[model samples]
Target: MRSIAALFSMLMPGVGQMYNNQFVKGVVFLIIEHYDNVFGSINKAIHLDFNGAHAEALKAVDYQHLLFYPGFYAFCVWDAWFHARAGADKTKTAIIFLVGGFLGEFAAIFSTHLPIPSLTCGLVMVIPMLAGMFIFRKQ
Candidate 1:
C-alpha cells in the first residue's frame, strides 16, 4: 500500500493522496502540480527534450518555477507514503526524499552544464526515490 501510494504520487503528484483517501488534499496537490507544470513549461520542455531538441527544451523552462518542482514533487511522494504507513517513523523516510529533492534541485540548477541538460533533473530526482524504495522495502 505504501509503495503503491508513493508510486502513484511519483507518476502524478496528487493521485497517491487520493489513493490514501485524502480527496481534498489530492485536489489541492493537483492544482499546485498544474500550476507548476504550466509556469515551468514542463510539458513543453519534456516534449522538446525527448525529441532531441535539448537546447530548446532548456530554453523553454522557467527556472523560477522549475526550481520549486523537485521539492514539491518529493514532498507529495513522501506525504502519501507517510500517511499510508500510519505512524511509521518519519526520519528514515524523510532522509531519502530530502536527499532526492536536494539532488534534483541541484541537477536542475546545473543542468545546462551537465551532459544531458534536459533530462538530468528528472533522472536525478527519480533515481534517489527508486533507491529509497528498494532500501527501505521492509519498512
Candidate 2:
C-alpha cells in the first residue's frame, strides 16, 4: 500500500493522496500542481531553454509561482507515503514535508540561475529529492 501510494503520487502529485482516501488533500495538491505548471511557465521555459532559446526561456519563467512548486510537489509524495503507511502522525509529517518542499523550491530557484545545462539543472532538482527520500524514509 505504501509503495503503491508513493508511486502514484510520483507519477502525478495527488493521485496517491486520492488512493489513500484523502479527497480534499488530493484535490488541493492537484490544483496547486497544475497551477504551478501552467502559471509558473516552467515547462515552457524548460522546453525553450533546451531548444537553445535562452532569452525566450528566461522570459517564460514565472519565478513567483515556480519557486513554490518544487516543495509542494515533493510534499505531495511525502504526505501520501505517510498516510498510506499508517501509524504516523499526519500533522507532524505534513509539517516536515512542507519544510522539505520549500527547500526543494529554493534549490530549484538557485539551480535555474546557475551556469548549467537544462538537463543538469533538472538533475539538481531531482538529486536532492531522491536523497531526501532516503534520508527521511521509514524503516
Q: Which candidate is the best by lDDT?
A: 1
Lowest summed lDDT across 10 adjacent residues in model 2 is found at 116-125
Per-prediction backbone clash count? 0, 1
Residues 1-139, model 2: lDDT tens digits:
7767866987789999999999998998888888888998878988887888876777788878777777677777777888887686666455555655666665566754655434555555455555555555663
Candidate 2: segments with Cα more than 4 A from true spot: 89-103, 115-122, 132-138
Candidate 1 CA-lDDT value: 0.89
TM-score, structure 1 vs. true: 0.95
Model 1 / residue 55 / CA error / Å: 0.7
Flag clash pairs in model 1: none
lDDT of predicted model 2: 0.72
Residue-level error in angstroms, candidate 1, position 118: 3.3
- Per-residue lDDT of candidate 1, residues 1-139 (tens digit): 9999999999999999999999999999999999999999988988888898888888999999999999999999888888887677788978998988999889888878876665778878888888987787677
Per-candidate TM-score against the hidden true structure: 0.95, 0.73
